[model samples]
Target chain A: MKARLRNFLVALLALAGHLALTSPAAAATADPLPSWREGPARQAIVKFVQTATDRASAGFVPPAERIATFDNDGTLWTEHPMYTQLAFALDRIRELAPQHPEWKTQQPFKAVLDNDLEALAAGGEKGLLELVMASHAGMSTAEFEALVSDWFKKARHPRFKKPYTELTFQPMLELLAYLRSNGFKTYIVSGGGIEFMRPMTEAVYGIPPEQVIGSSIKTRYEMQEGKPVLTRLPEINFIDDKTGKPIGINTFIGRRPVAAFGNSDGDREMLEWTGAGKGARLMMLVLHDDAEREYAYGPANGLPDTKFGTFSQSTMDEAKQKGWIVISMKNDWQRVFSFQPETMNPAKK
Target chain B: MKARLRNFLVALLALAGHLALTSPAAAATADPLPSWREGPARQAIVKFVQTATDRASAGFVPPAERIATFDNDGTLWTEHPMYTQLAFALDRIRELAPQHPEWKTQQPFKAVLDNDLEALAAGGEKGLLELVMASHAGMSTAEFEALVSDWFKKARHPRFKKPYTELTFQPMLELLAYLRSNGFKTYIVSGGGIEFMRPMTEAVYGIPPEQVIGSSIKTRYEMQEGKPVLTRLPEINFIDDKTGKPIGINTFIGRRPVAAFGNSDGDREMLEWTGAGKGARLMMLVLHDDAEREYAYGPANGLPDTKFGTFSQSTMDEAKQKGWIVISMKNDWQRVFSFQPETMNPAKK
Candidate 1:
C-alpha cells in the first residue's frame, strides 16, 4: 500500500517539475533557444525535446527516464588553451615549486616549472598522471574542495581573459535549463577529476555535485581528532574517457540517456551508447569550426591537431555514418558566450 | 544573461517539486508516518523533518542538499537466516550444478549442493567471494539484470513465504515517503551488488536504479554485433561495506548525506560521515527486537550474533555515546510489513 502511494507521490512531484517547463509562462516563447541559429543542429535538438516530452507522441519518454548527459571539457566550456584540468596541474606545479627545490630538476616537474609546453607534452600520459597525483590528492575531501574553490577565485582563462566559470558556453547553459524545465536530469560526464569539477559545477553549470560523473581517485575514511574525514588517496580509481565514458555513464546512471552531446573522439563511445537506446535519441558532436571566435583544431577540417580533446577524422566519419548530428559552431550558434555581442540568430531578431 | 534566467527557471522547478508534498491535500494528514508508534523515536523524526523543511528555521536545508541514504539488507528488509544475496548465491550454485559437475566436489560448491549450511558458514568471506564471482559475472550487464528479475519472480523468503521484495519494513517505507514528500532525494547505499538491487529498488522501495549505490564488479564496454554492451568481469571493483560505505557515498553521491540509516557496524562510517556534517542530522539504526514479527539476532539485548549483518556491542554503545537514535523494532513499529494486520499505533487510536 505504501509503495503504491509512494509511486503516486513521486509521479506527482515529477509531473510538477515537468509542468514547470512546459507551462505557457515558461516555454510559451516562439524561440525556446534564442541563441541557436536556424540550422539542422538547432532543429534536431528542439525537435527531439518536443517529441520526447509530448505524451501524445510515440517518442514520448517517461519523466523518470528522461536522462541527458554532456561531456564537460571542450563541449561545455573552453578546453583548448589546453584541457582546463591540464592547465590547473601546470599552474599547481608552479605554485608549489618554491616549496620543493628538487622539482626544478625533475623531468616532468622541470618541464612544467620552466614553462616548456613542448617538453611537458613529450612526457605524455605518464607525466600528466604524475602531475595529477601531486596536485589533486593527499588531503581531506573538504580541504581539496576548499583548495579548488580558492584556485577558481583567481584562475583566469589564458585566452578569454575571463574566469574559467565565466567561459561556459551561454547556449549550452540555456539547453541545460531547458532540459531541466522539461524534467530531464542533466549530468556532466567528464574525463576531468570529479573532485575538481564538483566545487564549481553548481555555480557554473547549475549541475549540483551529485549529477557530475567523472574520473576519480580513491578516498579513504579516517578518524582525525575523533572526527571522521574522507582523505583523498593518490591512486586512480576510474577514468571517464573514451570507452570509459559509457562505462561511467552506465555505472553512475542506471538509465540510458535519451540525448547526449560531445565535441571529440573521447566522446564517441558515449554518443554511441546513447544512440543505441531504442527511442528518438539526439546524439550531437560539436564541431569547432570557428577559430575566429573559439579554438578550432581537429582532423575534421584539416586543422593542426593537439593531444587535448582530439577530433579525429575517423570519429567525424563515424558520426556521419551513424546519422548523429554534427553541430557547426560557426553556423549553428548565434553567440558562444553571453559576454560577446549577440550575433543575432537569423530565425530571431 | 542565460545563467540568471537558468537559475530562476531551476528555482521555480525546485519550488514546484517542493510544493507537491507540502500541498494541503498531501501533507494535511495528522500523521505522515502511521506505521510508527508513539515514542521519542517517532517524535524525533517528525520534529526533524518539520524543522529542516521550515525556511524560517536555522535547520532548513536546501532541497538540492536534502540527500538521505539507507542501508538495504537489514535496515530496509529482513536479513536473518542469512542475507538475501547469500540465499541467491547458494541457489545459483544449485541451478548451475547440472552444467558444472565439478561443483559436486568443490569445497563451497559441495557445501551448497549438499545443503550443509554449517559448512558454508565455516567457509567465511573468501568462500563467499568465490560464489559471487562464479555466479554474478561472465555475462553482459543486461543479461545479469534479466537473471535477477527471473529469480525474484520465483524466489520466496524462507520464513515469510513471500517474495524478498514484499519483506520490506512498513515503517521504513513510510519514512522514505515522508522524506521524499518533504523534497528529500533518498538513495540506497548497500553492501549488496548494484545490479542486484537496481532491478527491484524502484518497484519495492520507490527508489530508482540511479539513486541506488552498492558494490560493483569490473565492467568492460565492448561491441557485440555492432551494438554496445557492458560485460561484467569476475573481479571486484569495490566493496560497499565497513569503511567502504563512506567512500562509496563520496565517490558516487559527492555530497555528505543529511540523514543515514543502517542496522549494522558496516554502516558506522557512513553514519559518522553524515553526522559530522553541520546541520540538523538524523542518524539511525534499526534494532530487530521483535522475534515474533521478524528474525532478531544481534549483540544487543543478549540476542545471538550472526555473520550476516552483525550488530556489535561496541557499535551499540557508540550509538548511545554519539546520540544516534536506536530504534527497537518491537517497541516502535506498529506493523512490520504491509500485509500484516495493524497493531493500532498507540497515539493514533
Candidate 2:
C-alpha cells in the first residue's frame, strides 16, 4: 500500500511540474505586446486588435481584411543620425568617387564627397534624386541586391556603434509580431527605395519582399550576353512620399490598410487613408522625445529640426485633431533597440 | 463465447469498410495534378516540382523562395471573343452613354458604340488607353470594386453564355492548388489592370488582392463631402506586358519566380527571366488550339493571328530553343472550364 501511494505521489508531482513549465507560455501568448508598457498607446493598439479580431464583436474585421502598414524610417528604427538609405548612398558615393573624377567639380557630388551638410541640403529634392540615381542605378537587380546585402553586414550606426539592422526598435518589432499573431498582414510602406529595403526587410522586420511598397527607379529588362537581366535605369519611376504614399499603397496593395504607423508628415496621407476606412482602425505616430535613450525630434520636444524625417508642428496638430495616438518612445517602450551599445564592436565606428 | 465471436466479426467488418472509403482519398493526394492529363506537359511540371521540393535534390528550393507567377487573361481564362476588360469597358460606355453625349462623335467611342471592331483596332493602343481611363477611373476604389463585382454577376460571355468568373481553366486551377500545396506562393502577374482583376482573383483563382500585380492608374487620396476618398486619376502607371513583365515581376515580387505560366508573347520576357534562374525551373505557355472547347489563335496549328494575345512565330521559336513546355490545351486538358455551357443562362447571351 505504501509503494502504490509513493507511485501516485510521483505521478502527481510530474504533472504539477509540467503544468508549471507550460503556464508561462500560455500567459506569454495572452500578453502579445509585452515590450510595450501598459499605457493609452499600448491600450489603444490592444483594443483595436481585440475588436478587429473578435468574431462576436460588432467591430470585427475579417482575417483577410486585416492589412497593417508601417513606415520604416523613424517609426521602426533610428532614422535620426541620418536616414539609413541616405547614409548608404553617401558611403556608396565615396566608394565610387575614384571612378568619376568629375564628381570633384560637380556641386552635389562635390558636396557629398566633402561632407558639406549645408551644401547638400541646398541641393534639395533635385540634388537628392541625382545622388540616388548615381548610387542606386547602373547595375543588374541581382548585383544590386548582393551589394546592399554586403553593405548591411558591415555598416554600423554612427552613434549607436551597432549594425543598422540591430537598431530596429524592439517595441515596434513586438507590435508587428503581435498584429501578425492576430491574423493581420503587415507591410512596410516607406519613402525609402523599394530595392534597398527588400534585401533586409524579411530578416530585420519580418516583412516579405512582396509586402514592401516603396519608391523605385525605372528598371529595364534586356537580354545581355544571352542571359535575361533587369538593368536599373537612372530615371525617377515613383516617389512614395507625402500624397504619393496613398498612390503607392493603392497601386501596389489595392486595398486600404486598417492600421498605419509612422513618425513624420510624410506618413500623413497613409494614416488618413487607414483612418478613413469604416469600423475599428489604428493610426499611430511615434514621437521621439527621449534624447537620453534614442534621439528626440519633432516640434513637440523642442529638438532640432531634421531634414531626413521631419515632424513639423502642423503634423502634431493634425494627429491631435484626428485622434491619432502619439506614442512617446521614452515612456512607452521598456527597451529601445534589440541590442545594447557596449555589446557592439565600438571599433566599427 | 457466441457474443465474443460476434464482436470480433463486427470489428473486422468495420476495418474493411474504413479501408475501402480511404484508399481513393489517399490515391488522390498521391497524384497532386489530377486534372492535368498524363502527358509530357504534365510530366515536366511534376518533375520540376519534385526536384525543386526534394531536400536531397540538387534543384531543391526553400519554401520561402518557392515563388510561382501566372498570367491571367489567355492563360487562366478565355481571352478570345475580345479581352474581358475591353468588353467591360464597352458595356460601361453604353451604360454611361446618356451622360456622355459627346461619346457619340468621339472616334474610339463611336467605334465602340457602333460595335465596329475593325475601326477600334485601327485606333490602336492609344484608343484602348482612352477607353480604359474613361471606364475604370473617376470613381473610388470601393465603388470600382462594387461595379466590377456587379458586372461579373450579370455579364455573360457572347459564345459561352457564362459569367467570366466561371470561365477559368480547370487544369490551371488544379495546377495552382498543387503548387500551393507544395509550399509555393502563387501570384498573378498580368498585363490586365490591377484594380479590374483584384475583385475576382480571390474568388476565382484563390489569389488575394495583394498577390495580384498588374498595370495601374494613379489614384489620389482626398476628402469628398467630409469623407475620405481615393479618386482614380486618368493617367497610365506601370504596364505589366512584354518587356514590362520582367520589370513588374522584379518591382513587385523582388524574388525571381521558379515557375511562370502564360499563353502569349507578352509572357516571353517573364519566361525568359524564369528560365535564366539557376536550377530546376518550369516555364510553360498554354497553346490555345482547341477551337471547339476554347478559342485558338496563334502562329501554330494554322490558327489565325490575334491582336489581343499574340503567340507569334518568334515567341514559339524561342520557346522551342529554350526548351520551354508549350501546353496543348486540346491534348493535355481533360476539361477546359470549371463549368459546362448547358448549365449557364442561354437567354443572357
Candidate 3:
C-alpha cells in the first residue's frame, strides 16, 4: 500500500512538471495575437491564417500565393493632426524658406510658414503638389534619402509628441510579424512616396524596399562630374490611391494579394480587389474610435470628417455588405503605440 | 591472423564508401559555374560572389543587399532573327489577321503578313508600338499571361529549330542558380514588356514575376459583372531601356543592384549606376562573337551592326575604360543552350 501511494505521488509530480514546461509555449502559440482583444476581428484573422496554412483545409494557400498588403498612413501608424509626409513637406518648406526670400510673400509658402493649415488646405491639391515638388525634388536619390532620414531622426508628432517612427501601431506590428511567421509575405501598398517609405520601412515594419509599392515622382539617370546619379524630378510619376491602388499592386507585385488591410476610403478598391479573388480571403479596416489614445475622425458615431484619412459612410456600408472586418481601436486593442505615454519625452515647442 | 586481415578489409571498405558519397557534393560546391569556362569573365563572377559572401572579407555584403540584375534578350537568351517578343508579336498578328480585314492593307500589318523585314524596320518604333497594342493590350492580365504561356509552349526558333524557351543560355542559367544558392536575389531588368517576360521568366529563368522590372502599358482596374479585372490599355506607361533601365530599377526594386549584366548599349546606364555605388561592384557585358553557335552582329571584328541589340564601338570603348568584364561567347561558354542541336524538333513551317 505504501509503494502504491508513493508511485501515485511521483506520477502527479511528473505531470505537474510537464504542464509547467509546455503551458507558456502552448499559450503563446494559441494566442498569436495577444494585443487583440477576444473579438470577431481577431477571430477572423486567426481563422483565415489557420485555414490558409492548413494543408487539409479547403482554403489552403501555398506560401508563394500567400500575399498580404497593408496601407501605411492611418492603418500602420498615426496620420492624425496631418499626414506624416505632409508634416515632413511643411517642415521642409520652412527649412528652405531661408534660401528663397520670396517665400516670405508667397501665398502657400507663407501659409505653411505661419502654421496656417486652413489656408494651405484651401490652396488644394495644386498647392500641395507645389510644396512637394519644391521640397522633394532637385536632389539626387541618395541626397534625398539622407535628407529624409535626417528629418525622421528629429521630427516629433504634434499631439503624441513621440518620434514619428515610434507612433506605429503596436497591434499592427504584431500582426505583420505574425503573418510573416505564417509564410505570408507582407507588403505595404501605400499612397505615400515610394522613396520616402523605402528608407525606413525595413527598420520600422520589417518590410524590405522591394515589398513596398507607393506613389513616386519621376527620377532621371545622368552622369554628374563623371559619376552616375539618379536625380529626382518635380513631375509626378504615379499616385497609388483609390483606383490607383489596384493598378499599382498589379504593376509592382504582379500578383493579387490574398488579404488586405487599410483604414480609409483610399483602400476601398484594394479591399474589393482582394475579396474578389476566388478563395478564403481577409479584408480589414482599422476604425479610429478612441479619442483618448488616438484621434477619432471616422464618419462613425457623429465623429468629425477629416481630409487626412477620410473613412466615409459609403466605405463603412461597403465593408458591411462585403463582410469585411472593421477593427475598432477602442474595443479591439489592448495597446496602441509601442511605448507608454509617460516614456515619450516631447520636444520643446 | 585471419581476424586481423578481416578488420583491415572492413576499414578500407568504409573509407571507399565515404569517398563515393561525398565526391559529387564536394565537386558541386567547389565549382558553382561549371558551364563557364576558365576565363576572365568567369573569374570576375566567381571572385565577386566570393568576396561579397565572405563575412571576414572587407567587401562582404549582407544577404539582403546582394541583388544581381540581368538584361533578358541578348544577355540571357538569343535576340538574333529579331527579339523573341517581336517574333511572338508577328505570330499573334498572323493569328488575328483573319479577324481584321483592314490589317491586310495596313503598311506595318502588310509588312508583318508578307514577312518583309526591311519594310517592318522602316515602320520603326511607332509601328512596333502599334503591333504591341494590337496583340498585347485590350485583354485582361490573366488572359494575356495564358496567351503568352500557350505561345511559348508551341513556338520554335527558325535557326535553332528549338522552342524559344529552350534557347536560354545554359551558362547564365547556371549563373542565376549559383547566385541564388549564395543568398543573392536575381532579378530580370529587361527592356521587354513586363507581361510578356513574366509568363516565361519563372519557368525558364527561375525568376518570379515580382522580381522582373520591365517596360509596361497602363492598366485600369474595374469591376466587370461584379468581378474585378485589370484591363491593359493601349498606351505606354514606361519604358525600361538605356536611361530608362536605371529608372525602372529604382522604381521597382528601390535598391541599387550590386551586380549587373547586359549585352548592348541599352544597359550602359544600369551598369554605370551599379558601379557608382560604394563597396565592391561587378559589371559585365556579353560580347556575341560566335557565328556558328550564335549570330555575331556587334561592331567588334567588322561584324554587321543590326538594330535589334546594337553593341556599338563606343559602348565597347566605354566597357574597356570602365573595366567591365567582356564575356566572349565562343571562348567562355562550354555550352550555349540547355538542349543540344540533335534534340530539337522544329515546328512545321
Global lDDT of model 1: 0.88
RMSD of 2: 7.7
Q: In candidate 3, what are the lDDT values of residues A1-349, reduced to their tens digit? A: 2445445544544554455455654345456676777889999999999999999998999888899999999999999988999999999999999999999889789999998989999999999999999999999999999999999999999887888999999889989999999999999999999999999999999999999999999999888899989999999999999999999998898889999999999999999999988777999999998777787897854688888889999999999999999999878887788675522322211
lDDT of 2 by residue, B96-212 (tens): 888999999997999988999899999999999989989999998889989998999999999989998888998899999999999999999999999999999998999998889
In terms of TM-score, the best-performing candidate is 1
My TM-score estimates for the predictions, one after another, are 0.92, 0.90, 0.90
lDDT-best of 2 and 3: 3
Error of 2 at A109 (Å): 1.3
- List model 2 lDDT by residue over A1-349, tens digit each: 2445445544545555455456654335466676677789999998999899989998899998999999999999989788999999999999999999999999799999999989999999899989999999999999999989999999989888888998898889999999998899999999999999999999998999989999999998888999999999999899899888888888788888999999998999899888988878999999988776788876755777877678888888989999999998878776778664422322222
Residue-wise C-alpha lDDT for candidate 1, range A76-101, written one tens digit per residue: 99888888878788888788889989
CAPRI verdict (incorrect, acceptable, medium, high) for model 2: acceptable
TM-score of 1: 0.92
Candidate 2 local Cα displacement, residue A29, angstroms: 4.3
> Share of real contacts kept by model 1?
0.61
Question: How does chain A of every candidate compare to the true chain A by TM-score?
Answer: 0.90, 0.89, 0.90
RMSD of each: 6.2, 7.7, 8.9
